[model samples]
Target: MVGKKSGKALRDEGLERTDNNMDLSSWPQVQAINQKNYYTDYLKRDDQYLAFRLQNEEARTKMTKTAKDRDRALAMAKPEGAEGEAEADGDATMEDAEDTPIETAGSKVIVIHVGSQNLRIGLSSDALPKTVPMVIARKASKNESEDHPEPKPKRVKRDDGTAEEPENLFGEEWSSQFNRMSADLKVHMRQNKRRMLPNSKEMVVNFNRRTVPETISEHNDPMRVEWTELSKPPPEYIVGQPALRLPDSSNPRYKLYWPILNGCCNETDYKSKRELFLDISLILEDAIKTQLGLTSKKNWPQYSCVFVIPDLYEKSYVNQVLEMLMREFAFARVCFIQESLAATFGAGFTSACVVDIGAQKTSICCVEEGMCVENSRVNLKMGGRDVTETFIQMMLHDHFPYTDINLWRRYDFLLAEELKKNLCTMDEASVSPQVFDFHLRVAGQDTQKHTFKAFDEVHLAPMGFFEPTIFDNSDKLLGRRKLIERSVDIYDGQSNDPVSTAQSEILTALAPPLPKANGDSQPASSEVQATPARPQQPSALGRLQDQDQTPRSSVAGSPVPETNGTPQAGGANTPAAAPTTQPSHPAVESRDDILPVFPLDNAILTSIAHAARSDEKKMKDFIGGYYGRWRGHLDQWFLDERLRSLRPAFTKDIMIGVPPRDLDPQVVVWKGASIFGKLNATNDSWIGQLEYDRLGHRLMAYKCMWAY
Candidate 1:
């Protein structure tokens, strides 16, 4: 408390009585902060709230645009009875202008490479393609008649003000424009349809599949006099990046669907086959418009497209996809490319064993001189998602036991992916001391901080590829090295080493005849025995024939017996000596035997060494870290001297392994498609729109021939 003599004191100490607090309220920074607070208050919502508002706003905007579009379209579609003279005058004025085709090989090219997890799309001129989640959600609609299109007119006027010309009817431009407009109409109508829950009075099929009557009352029944249709929102197909949010339960009415999976048309989806194709086409259009920044609607018909599909895509599916694209999008030109070839070419590899690790599985294929070795291609059910799941389970059981499994599977799976990106390492060690810290968020819970160490568990995901036991029935899967071995063998036939060749011949020559049962008379031998036959056990040749063990390679310099003219030594595994008392089978004949020999070719070893020296992480990690656990199959393939010897003779350069992301395998397909488009332009190799139409679905067979 201050004393009451302040006035007198103030008079005595004049200016000192004034308040000394600095006035910072008028500063720009303070004002800016205040403005931010006001802005936040004005918006006042979380993501879901904003999304709700934005969706409604978008619906309004779409309706306005659609109404305006409809009006403009109707005006354009008006019969030319009255406007014939005006249009004739315009055509007369523009008659000097020459008509040109819209599609040209030199035009812009669009490449879309669809993977199980993402879609990589870009213009051929761009350095890199844009990636978006391969997902789509159909939107909700309020009114059924909003997009109910009228029966299309018999003929639509051209933008050039010309009446329908008979010759131009078959013209590329007219066909493309017609197809595009028709596709757009169909898409709008499809989006406008309301997806209703079975009527409230109808039955509800619960998870148990029990049909129970829905909780509905007579008051809400449509049959009631006062009942009316409730206001419903307009439906739209949520596609690409935006569709990712549908899984959060924000808009339960919108279900997500994948138009393409594992790099081909999706067989399992919530959408119809035609619907799926339309969705993918729509997504492609959106990607072109939004991501590539190609806004001019007229420029669409001028673009060519390349779709990179997986090697395993069925012929029928390929035909269907091609037909759909040609009928729906109707780009100037379109071509199909296999995913493996594209990746290999994109990586600038002349010869490589590309191990593509995708979301659904890991596909390995060998490419020699830009061609995929058909027989060597193999697929594994383990991939990035599998690794994430393993990590999630580890965290749930070993680290955070209280977290809900279902919630983690739904929401935290993304966190697991993030964790993998941050903490996962491909170090060539059985165990690593890598440690990382990250946050995990549950739907209704606070974010929890987690410190994850013991990267041994993290290695399990990649290791699972080498050791199949990490997952169920994975033991049937082949390891990376084995895949390479098999691919090399397929590329270069059986061993070419002279010694192996000779040994194989000798073994084939010495193969004993099939042994007869005791009840049957023994087969007579060509050579007669000097000693009288003793009624005793079966002869040594008969016993050996009976054993019939899988033939294996003999060690170098093993002894060969000449008694009874029997085949030299049975095999390296066979004993050096046999009892002299046993007589040789009389019917036995001298012949070379075939032996199972896994020769580790020197070229293969050299290839592996080259890969290791070049810092190929997958091969390096496989050799240093995974070899011990995966040696059984690896040894069978790599330990053979013949394979090692044949490796040098292998003319093509061999790449040991490819890491999933080393060269950005995700976008590699797009890059490959771009390369193919350029090559097609240079060599005039691409099939034209006219040719495609003439051949129809047979273009796929032609593509296959060209690809092989």
Candidate 2:
């Protein structure tokens, strides 16, 4: 009976046996806390409500039923063996696969590009990738999550002692409710930034924002309050965008972060590292459903996932995290591709150097014949954000007499980024400094005139990529042109010095002719007899090896017999007799012919590197394509004279390939990733789940070596 006793009864009996034991339930404050809220009853008397509570409940039931019906209709519309349709406006379907017959195998292809700032998702054959800010904001209230809260997994033990297939704990009712809530909240948040409230008489003029109130007074009108806030219990986490915390919230535990920073997951903080791992998996799952049209939870495991990351990040722990996610999500197959390499292939190039300039950093790599040259890749910690920050610092330095650090902190960096996109120009001459005047509102102060001279100074910020020191970086900081030069220098040697160590090494490796055959008797002429006869054997140095075997004619300008056995005579039609024995000089191939092959033959800069690509063109003095877009003061300080010197004879030019006119620069990587998925499907390049489980990270690491 004791063993069967309830836990509460056993605890109470133990407490009674102890003389000094105190019963917390007997405490007056504890009792009061447990009592019903009488104030809420008083408040409810004045609160607006339906004539009957039953009617209100019935209305909610009807709405719930309607949402279920809609979801069912949507599900019914999607038939088995039918390919998911790409969004008509946001994304374009790529050249239809020659054999797109829907896979009867039940597996689907989903390509996802997770960048430092945004996430792009689309089906394998989609021409364009749908982009979403890699953001997932969570509200603190459990109630808010009821509608679209993430599905909870339940573990079930099997007879074999291993965990069986996990079950989704939420029922259809919750799923439908969550879906409706997600739709409503999305609409609310999107419309929250509008200049005018929907169906409202008031216009939200400059600096005036419609605000939501916590509660309505009994005497005041409830509908008069414009609801701008989209979250309840405030948002506990905001991803992608800047972090915010409401000071008035009771529990303002907020977290905003990027799962990836500098192109990889943060390894320093274990908690954040794990959180990011889970977050990316969840985000990718959503992409599979929303973008690939695989809504059935069971079918999720049948989707192949491809993650695009920087080439330099292969050695990082990202591979490990990806493997973990692969198993956790039960994906049909998975693979990783380098962002720049994907872009190169997507641009339809067998080889081209790639320069990827993103929001947080820039990477330059040489690709040759479908392989990335590991030694030639360079990653720099400078990109679009730094330019915007430079603009912000410039404004703060000039405008606010007594700079409030908070003011600077509160300023919208996104707005500054947009301004940079619009007003920033590549040509220094176009920078016309204009006096800008605008009304500024501080958190606690009245609106005031915030006036400052906005000059072509904006153009100077982009020059940081060219001259890192302007942004307080060391001389080691490499600009776009310098990046290209670095790649070329690997083969051509430094321009300032004629003989590069690489060139010398190559020269040393070329074998000299075998010791001349000993001419018995008299010591072989004291004068070293030049071996006019080239080596019979070919060399590693290609045809550079000398193969001529003819004695020099002592006559000063005598024409030598042509190798074709044609006797040359000085005639008007005859070219000067080919000087076969003129000079046995070592072969010096032009830089173009000897350029080391890389994964990409040309340096193709995606949209983010528009500034760098533009600056590089100006440096090289190229005046075609997008070069006409440059309209700025010519700043010599930002120029790389070395690039100008090398331009005339430089064999290879950094190529910023012209993308399809409708494609956005930002989506280039995703488009490439999408195309890659299609190629993988056709080529059977992806590692299937069974093989992945068997080979594991070793296979992943091995593939990373040449996955591009």
Candidate 3:
């Protein structure tokens, strides 16, 4: 407001003046001036502000220069050796990077492997996951507490001293007698007619001989356990190991349930989808709280999770699980990996035919590199539990010592499972009848020793996989349960057209009349002719009208009039109407449409054939080995024999490689999940809460690593 001063006068007074009055909020020079004034004032009045400003200045001076700055310095004739020394320092830093702990999200990562029988959970840094039986025992209501009367125990058969002892068939004397009998039988068969011409070329078979130990160790008895009856009242809920150990006597107080069955959600067992989801949530929450020591909900936001899903998975199942982890558990972020891919990672194989036989389901898929081959996935709705039930049936038929055995009971179920593991063998050496003794220990009862002999029962029990018909004879529903149907992806929209019902009905009713078969054509009615004709174009329903066809009336919901085979007065220029038909849509094939069960050998061959259709190299690589969670009774040779017997032509060039004996197949999937969890690139693939909130299910299409 004062009188304007000259430039030299303003310089002398250290003051500046301007005539322009427009807003300078966006002006860089004005901003610099204001910032400098604020900084100076704060430096004088605030000690913290002064210290912060000094620290920022020091950091700015030490920061590395940009390319432009380096080029300018070189133009000024600075030393060239400085750039080389800087690069040398960077190289040295990279070389020593191994000693530095990788700064990654893995430290806060929790890997969860949810299986039908067990739930494996642990941090990414853990050497092994904490395994818990995927079972829950809910407290029963008063109405559910009615108990059934227990059956009386069967009387044990006494070994009478009057019977004569049979000759030992496994001793040396019996072997000599068998050889003599075989020689006489061979002579009689030599005179039989030749079935076919002999091969022109001699076929040679190579066998890898394994040395047997000179001193065999005694088989340890697995039947020494004593089952103690629970005397206390059941809690609100039981999970994991304790749930499995609940005695049969306490069955009236609790109801046992397995939330997952046959590699899919056990929705059929629950009242609604909500209840099934609730149980699954409770199981995971309990496992995380007790096993991972994460008791506080507030701390959950600090951790991320990686869920392992099936190779042939349902989109809805995966979506529901992700929602549960994110919205219910409040995890920071979540990611998913396929089981077959994870198995390949854990086994350190670039490509392999993964035959993952779990407690309730067996999944076959060929994984190359890190991706699973499409169409090669086959999920069989049968596994170890089927074998267990089959074994129990076989034993019962042979008058098993425990005649009152009920597999539904906890004790008897455990007993049968243990007996199958102990007595079953695929080796030809143990094909003869063998005597096995098991000590039956019931809660609140005396221990009793029971002796039984098994001949082909042990062998036939495990053969249920190859001969699935044996499972049909048992009470268990084999391959009856269907997988959850996959929901339509949000990105694909709906399968049906978006036309309104009323609009479609009106359009159908107003459809033009069909013309006669002769060359002559009838003219349209006066009402149709009176309406203003618009340019012909495709309708909203995506149907196109031909120019030669009769023009349709624009009036909505109009009814067709009776022509009585008479032509209109002004008729001759109209063209004949073409025949119109409804568009046909192809039926969409779902998971339920496919067969749910495949024999062991057939599944392998089908999987290889599927791979061969895509890439022959992948098929050859997959046929090289069969990697899976095999039991002690089912060896590689057994699978090989089944393949040869089922399809001799297919097995002609196939050689199945055996995995290392010491490699535990049980934890292979879990280990692979852990490996995926530790990957630095996983950070970018995780779906965070903010992203999910904005996109919802649509986020899966963009963020999911696999084919969503």
Candidate 4:
């Protein structure tokens, strides 16, 4: 009791007498203790309150859980149910569909709308993203130096049976090594024509024996790097534009570096996607800086972009693009889509059939009822650039290729795209030869005239505006491959194998009966080869087919990589090149069947197989048209009655209690649209274009609306 009293007295004295118990370094440090305590006192009070609230929350959570358990137990133990249920028993885990809980892990992942080019990066937000496209660029350059040389690949033969080394086609150490060899060859020719490499020692002695070092110095003479033009190598680009690094139009065909972007429209190897990406990224970054004035030195390309690329983008080209982005743009996420899909998505709600006629290529995506008709996607290799190429080849045929380009090149293809976009009509007979004679100035000179009838004869069989015939001649050159896949061959050899109803169902569902008629199901007993659950079993000769193997460790049907620089080849586990062996009897020629206009290339191919010989040409035309129809299909997806039902029934707002302080409760709780709709609505862009005023009459049961 006495000790306790003494301790209390000391505490009291310390609190009352401030400076007496405080630490003092010399003298000035005494204030540090006072300053620290003064600030900490208010914090200590707030911390105690926080601790009390946390304990209260814990107690509340436990009570709530206990109450829930009790209520559940009571319900299970109900007298009428429990006593009567003594007759009924079942497995504990098994449940009806209505009782099944939501499986969060298996929830469908929703795609978000963002920009067009980027890589992954950190954001301050807590939400983990559902999907991200790889936009990172890879680095590639010709490394011919001794210290950092490129690895050599084993030589391989070309399809036509010519063997070539990698260096023969790829770059080599020509600048330094070739120069030395040239000097040696000149010296040898001047002094010792008869002195072969095997006679080097004998020749040195026989040639009046200059010291080896002296000879070497003379060959490597500093004067060799002189002002004379004879020593320089001739430039490589003596003719037309170069080829693409990746097989697109962007990079010139001959440049050392070529990384093509989706929708590229220029020479490939000479320019690169990296160059274009930088221009885009800079525009975005500067726009952000101008608007927000963010001072923090953070990473760049903070958001992401979507890129649409062809299926055959080469590995090296993709890698180079990613490497450049990493080196230049700071950090971003890249999203990849089929260029057709992007155009369709962007234009889906606006047009019934989207025909994206760009500078380099034209694509068709047919949308029926506002959803992308998966079966009706089509991409034509011919674009406005093909028109320009046709014009150039026409000039070449006329012996004025170089002369004409100097007159009009830049605006040529651009004009072609504009023409297709603005002037093209579905009427074939209306397409006249005189339509091409529109005059444009060449290099600001007197107006020059040209006509489509004067089309370069070279492209007569090449530029297929709405048909696959453009590639027919080239494709014919690639004969049937020596090794057709065994699986396809065996599948074809079967006889009396009943044509399964499943295959017919898939094909016929594509063409539903007219509007008032109920859809008919293919009878289960029909005899057709069963859906083998494979796409192809062979490799494309020139079609850039993908190998039928799982990509990395991903399971079958996982989407192909969605990266800005990466190539996309449909779904995972795609077959390379399946044999197309026609069946013996009626399968070869079905007379009365009409092909479904489902707006997809694969669908067209399927339809083409059943078409009459006379109709084959017309079916091929649909392949090119499919790409343009996709937009029309996707535009209608928003009009789906299922989408409309999700919207809030009432337009009026209700008052909840006041939100927590500083909570920025402006969060919009959309009534009907899913998360995707909210995101699409972010800027009132595409979704808003669908006027809400006319939506009243189209309402239907939600499930039936979006259902397939």
Candidate 5:
């Protein structure tokens, strides 16, 4: 009874004894006891307990700091002077300075933008890319040398055998005819100007015209490099500007080759795929060595590459280029962005209908949210060069001052190109006949200054894009060769060995396979028949059709199944009893089709229609705005008509974005690629060296940001 009586008294007695002992104990013993208790508790607790304690400590610290801030703000009195405002701004700046810098994997990136006319290459840090003409000159073989011997400069002599007085390079009759034609054209243009509707007139204002001081335009004389001035002969292989500068006399010794043509690989020039790739490698190697100043291949491994490809690209072209970068050049990593997407990025637009009129091709694509709508891609086989050729043809017919204009000759080609750039104008106000001077400078010959008169020819040349029939007279169109689409490995169709049926079946599970030939089809085995069918998922098109109430078929002209059956009113012999047929919509011909190429306007409309089928938002974006990148003259009449036609399809007026005055349309794609190069890298989007090593060229399919 005495022992149990005092449970509360015993606790109270123990607490009093502990307090008395603590007051009497030494400090060292007290510290040792506390440390022992902490170690015992630490050993008993799990990681979860420790984590909870750490989180609680963090919360308490944050709350204390916040309270301190609040108290300081309440204690400080607001000041009314500029000094007080400066102090407030300084505090804001200090707070902003605490933010960490964003990390990017583009420090050592090498951005490459390859085009038919030029190859742009530079580091991601470069403000402007180093441009090189996409042309190479190699030593001619023995057969080529035999076939194209050097031609001695020929002088036209009169029948009397004495050298005739230098005739007007422009024949007298030809000059007279052109002079009259120019006058007539001027009259017609004036009449057309008068007929233009007042409401349709474009109002242009030059607010800075008076403020802008007139500066004297300086003309630099072309550098005279005589053959005798050269201490050594040209190198065995010449690339870029050097190749373009080679005198016509050197044509026999060197065979000029363009690695790309009409926005694709120039496969027709080379006898084999290996040779084509070799030439491409050589050109790229030269650019990296000379322009980048990375003379040794050893440094290439340290850099990553952002290759800008065409919007309507060939899979083989992408694969080969990737392989060349990762395997041939040993790049650290590789990524690909379509030209349209890169153009949008460079131009800083979230959505646009990119109309890129390049040197040899005009590509159209609708880009949305950094992704290109594949169905909207259209590549025309004509561009700036076509305009140049057409311009030259017009000049020739109009008694051009330079009658010896042969595009095959380097000097003549350069002179014609220069003339085109200087004279061509899209503005109607600038189309009056004007006298322009050009200095014809050919290597190993004296520079000759010639004055020429240009009228409608300047504007008419660029009109070839709208009225393509004008290009029919040019040799480029007549002599154009059809190039076979190149493929690799399994796609090449050269393999004699049969493809594995098991692999085909696996692919079929993912997507419907192409119909097999009657001879290729094999009987299924009992084991194959016994296997259970995998659940089939609806395809994108199928799902879209499902959402739509209208009966539809995947292929045009294919019969649609009748969901609601009704007995025919007519007998079996009647026409109504026969199966009803849906009229087939005319298919848009492919690039390889023998039919005429689709017109630009129709192509754009078709692209928009395809976009509508897949996504309504994307269709709106496609019709929203146009970003034109044309170096040559743009046909305003055609463009305006296209816009007018599209107005009914959209509620809002379509916009055509005008590029900044300082931006060069020719290099916009390259600039976009540079922008992409600076973006933060993602493992799934970029193909690093390790991934390339494991997957080879196939890495593009898995790692490419867009659908491969």
Candidate 6:
């Protein structure tokens, strides 16, 4: 970072700090990503293997098991505390006090933990576990909505009953509800309006980026027609005022654009852990209506389920992805497991840790004796995508030295998934383990030498909450300086601007003084300045003389060929620029003088205005940590309390599965999510609106680790 400009310096001319997110098309497609061949290509060939969602057959059986066990446990449990303790003191028969249930509802049960990826259903009778993916068809829309846009007529019971809705008949699966909703009084939120207010700050935060930007205008071309002059208005309105031209402004489907879970229209606007939960649940409930008819409240099914996800687990994508899932199951409930203790009971892993590796980030947490530890948790920016990007860069540098988008196209998402399932782990044995080689070719020509097997198992990969670094056998292993320097020399625009020149200097300037492979102490850099045309090149070379071992790789490549196809670098005859290599990634740092980013809900209106005027770098700085931390904190809190009460009931270890609608309430379920925006654990989670045994027990858990 020596010669590299800090984010502030990069803010003016539009160079992003981190190039994580470049161009992601949001244009509505004829098909959803789920319906596309691209996404399905990665699914393992064992597609026949069952996905363990709450509705799976095995999950139904668990509900029966849990109900039985709960009946037994309560029967065997001691009665009132002191009195029973005293009675058991002498008469051994006192142990038979039997903490029996107040009455017998005679109902079986199951706990459904709705996860972003999978839905788990637990049976109480046997505590058998079954899970099915939360996945439904993205293309499976309301096949009947348009034809029948009305809520199914409600049924009334005459058995001395008050008017009631489907709440009494809640056990309906999501698929069947969609059809029913279409046939009934249909509900839709498409009529609402949303707009982000403006600000005078003249800077904006870009929400769609994966990494913090070095400059605000890096990716976005904000339409800004600064008023240079004003023209008089027509006749009556022309009273001494001048007419001004403004860029067209509109916010269509703004509600659809904000985060599905956290984006509230107002402070008290449908926000609460419950509302978020209800959103997915309601969507799912509607999905089920589409496939089945409804009955009177008294004749309704017995359970409800909603998808739960840790806020930061899938990076900040949890909400966006959940929305996509909701597109599949309308009544789906996407809950942040870390924000609700009930979620921990849903994921199923108690007395252990859950570590989730998602697309853009990683998160970990622990549950002890079925209770999650609120204070202990970990979240990192590096996730499967980050790792894959590193791989892609490696392939570009070592394998394909060309710049053809097609060669490396159509795989950003697929490759990221591969990293999640195929890479990442802890291996303490071999000298180098997690690293492996990759092949990359844009147009043609060797770009870089691939090296890396897994995350950090080979060469040390960066690891930290914010900052990270790795080893480099090549020159200057800090920023992507060397490669950037080469790019400057090769490009036609040359090194005119401050950024290009500054980058070149950052790369070649700090030449670590060291002997060549032959071990010869190099000459002084001041004496190395040789070219007048590339004025600063030789002077920058002086910095390399001090390194123990200077690097060799440049930023992702050596120039390829001319349009006519010819090699662009050092040949057998030409002794060119000294081989300069550097670290694979650009060094990202947090600075004290850094621009401030406010809490999202605190100043929404002003932030929106600033975002419109400012560039991408400033925008990311404003939103980066705030959005990430909000979700992280939420996941932590939700899990802690949910697991507290489930501890005693986990008397015996067992794998729980899904149960039927009539039997779902008798079992426990677990859900996992990230720790941001998470509330602290508490003891009042026994009354969760989840399916539980007659004993009134509901268990929850999240995906994470204790790091022990």
Among these predicted structures, which one has the highest lDDT? 3
Which segments of model 1 are wrong by more than 4 Å? 1-107, 139-235, 262-265, 295-298, 407-410, 428-435, 442-446, 472-665, 681-685, 703-708
User: What would the TM-scores of all predictions be?
Assistant: 0.47, 0.48, 0.61, 0.29, 0.61, 0.27
Give lDDT tens digits, candidate 1, residues 3-85.
66667776887743666797757865633356545543554554233334443565599899999998985776536676887
Tens-digit lDDT string for candidate 3 (536-577): 111311121122133432111111222343232121233222
- lDDT string, candidate 5, 484-503, tens digits: 35343476554221122211
- True-structure RMSD, every candidate: 39.0, 32.8, 22.5, 30.9, 21.1, 33.8
lDDT per model vs. reference = 0.45, 0.42, 0.60, 0.28, 0.58, 0.28
- Best by the TM-score measure: 5
Cα lDDT over the full model 4: 0.28
Count steric clashes of candidate 6: 196
lDDT per residue as tens, model 2, 424-510: 655534444354434333333343444444443465556445433223221111121211221123455543212222222222221
Q: Model 6 — which ten-residue stretch has the worst lDDT?
A: 250-259
In model 5, which runs have C-alpha deviations exceeding 4 angstroms? Answer: 1-105, 141-234, 473-598, 614-620, 635-638, 645-652
Cα lDDT of model 6 by residue, 1-708, tens digit: 489787877887688566668556687556447544454444354332222222244447888899999898667766576676755663664444555345322122323344333344432222344544232211112222222332122123346754333232212221132223222211221122212223201111121111121322312424222321313431211100011111111011001100121111111222443433444454334333332223222323342223344422322134333443333332212233342233345333233333333333343333344444442233322333333443333222222222221211222223333433344322212212223433332112222323333212111111111111111111111122211221122356443211212122222222223346898744323223221111112222222222213332112111111212222222222233343332111121111011111111111212211222233333232222111122111232222222222222221321222223323321222422222112223312122222222111112222222111
TM-score winner between candidates 2 and 3: 3
TM-score of 1: 0.47
Q: Kindly give the stretch of ten consecutive residues in candidate 2 with the minimal lDDT sum.
A: 593-602
User: Which runs of model 2 end up more than 4 angstroms from their true locations?
Assistant: 1-107, 136-253, 267-272, 286-296, 400-411, 437-451, 472-642, 645-648, 651-655, 680-684, 701-708
How many clashing pairs does model 1 include? 42
